[model samples]
Target: MLQTYAMVVNRNKNRTKLSTSSVEKNINVVNTVKNPSNENINKMEQSKKPAKRIIGTKIMEHVKLQPDKIIMKKKVFCLSNVKKCHRDDVVEFLQSSGINVITCFPVIKRTDENDPKAINNDEHSTMFRVCVEKKDEGKMKDPEVMLQHIIVREWKFNEKKLDFKNG
Candidate 1:
């Protein structure tokens, strides 16, 4: 069980920035103490985590789990005619069979122009694909028992039109 921690900084440290101008009869004290708007709080440079998931053991540190646990005998399986709703059910069934799910994603229904910069390209896949690692001997359960009626087949890697550019 790896644990991650983020630095907790006190945003309440920098109290109201007091300033007095000779031109004004009254000093304008920007009371950030109970200010309804917290615009100033965010500007303080204490610390914050990135808004995205990090890959490796960053210098800040966390007890990271070793990457790529499925070292050998990895298998890719394709589940056909799977809807978005039944996706979880399929994964649960597979896990019950004593296999570890390495990666699972839907097959994009639309075709890409092989352009990474393409704006309108989207995924509308009606099927789901999963890369699984077997528990011990890498044996898969029978297809008939999975989700009552779902076709399972081995997914093979195929060369795309612009494999180099996209890959």
Candidate 2:
């Protein structure tokens, strides 16, 4: 009976050793599959990603291509009290006053119902919408101070001009 008990203990020890070695071999195989050499990892990283294009870099390239053209921002303005002011005369006047006016045209109102400040149905006064370069925006305010019987108001983008009273 003692000999039989010793044989059972020896069999358990051998089974434990076999299981531990099998576990170690599995761990080594998994590590080798998951992580390759450092040189292989670098090559895989390079092949996986393509070269990226930056937006600012592309814009700069176009800007660099045009050397002669001066990039100027556009600004809009509302010129009021243009009762007898001709479009050509106004353009010439603005240009002469150091205001670089790109374009100016009369803003004709179809009806007085839209405008609350309209005194009467026939009280639609001649107004002009003017567009100029951003650098010449300061010149728009000058027309109000320099010219008589004319109101100059800077029009903001995507915003409605509420005040239409001649100042």
Candidate 3:
């Protein structure tokens, strides 16, 4: 059977209700004689219809691909040495501590001369995500609340800890 099956798939099914005034909703089917050679030729010609290209308008121009490079400049801290120390004391200590008072700050990949260079050029980059650290006083005031803040607001994540082979 040689019938033109025109399936005018509506682009906006839910966003725009298809009123009788919106689109010229019509189906035109024409059946002709059955001929194998002619049908195959027709199908071949149909396949050459440029694969239904989507040409965007001037206002909706194609977007350029974004580069993988990212900069992480936000400051955050990681608490350390809690044994034999009270929570409030620790928070206070961290806020006004001594030299090199170790706390986690965001660090991007730095290629120093002493370290081995990345084997894959594209794969290895010094890009890091922004991280947020709550104030020590805010955290100590409500531990659970601070934890929730960290869970929700913290942007930096441990990417190296992922087990890629299993994944």
Candidate 4:
């Protein structure tokens, strides 16, 4: 069996590495555990690891946890009307006019908002990611392109949506 180490804290708040037994000394203990369950270990490890992202849900089959988050590459995409095949129009219009189009700029989570409060706190945050596939992509980046093409409305998306259960 593999042994796990626990840390002990002193009155001065200094962390000291000690053996499993140190109670007679009247020392303060933090995370004092002889053996923790595998689940606890996993939670501790996951906190240290960065958030994992996946392109499509199909890739989630390899792991027990489904990768609910989405990730997009360096392509610029425009989502217009569904009837217009929003995917193709945005890519086409941009490239035809010259803006270094990537075509099919997959709708992934936008990294603009580092904190979650920015979305929920706002009074008028009209579901961005929901219509991301039908929103403006390069408008935020390139103003000149959108300025000229005023006739066509562009859709933009931000943030990834998560699923949760409620009673």
- The TM-score between candidate 4 and the true structure equals 0.28
The local distance difference test score of model 3 is: 0.39
Off by over 4 Å in 4: 1-21, 24-27, 30-47, 50-86, 103-140, 147-167
Writing each residue's lDDT as its tens digit, candidate 2 over 1-167 gives: 35544434456655534445877999888987798879878887798687884433234554546545555678999988777556777778788888888877666566854766553423334787789888888777764544787888876467656564952
Error of 3 at 13 (Å): 41
- lDDT of each residue in 1-167, candidate 3, tens digit only: 79888889877875856565423443212123233467777996798577664533344346685436633323444432223333334334434532122233222245543454433332322222222343333443445533233322233446767565885
lDDT of candidates 1 onward, in order:
0.59, 0.71, 0.39, 0.45
Question: In candidate 1, what are the lDDT values of residues 1-167, reduced to their tens digit?
Answer: 99999999988787764465544423223444456245655654334435675445434436465456424446788778665444566567677877677766666544644645333323334576777765422445465456656667778788646555653
Each prediction's total of clashing residue pairs, residues at least 3 apart in sequence or on different chains, is: 0, 0, 1, 5
Model 4 RMSD vs true structure? 16.2
> For model 1, where is the 10-residue window of minimal lDDT?
117-126
Return the TM-score for each candidate structure.
Answer: 0.40, 0.44, 0.17, 0.28
Candidate 4 at residue 52, lDDT? 86
Query: Between candidates 2 and 4, which one is better according to TM-score?
Result: 2
Cα lDDT for residue 40, model 4? Answer: 77
Model 2 C-alpha RMSD to native: 19.5
Question: Could you tell me the TM-score of candidate 1?
Answer: 0.40
In candidate 3, stretches whose alpha carbon ends up further than 4 angstroms from where it belongs are 1-74, 98-156, 160-167
Give the Cα error of residue 147 in candidate 1, in Å.
2.5
What's the CA RMSD for each of the models? 21.2, 19.5, 23.1, 16.2
Whole-model alpha-carbon lDDT for candidate 1: 0.59
- Residue-level lDDT of model 4, residues 1-167, one tens digit each, is 99999987666656676665667444333333546668878988789688886555354346677646645444333332233223445546556655444334333235736655444422233221112222334453465765443333344446756454631
Name the candidate that leads on lDDT: 2
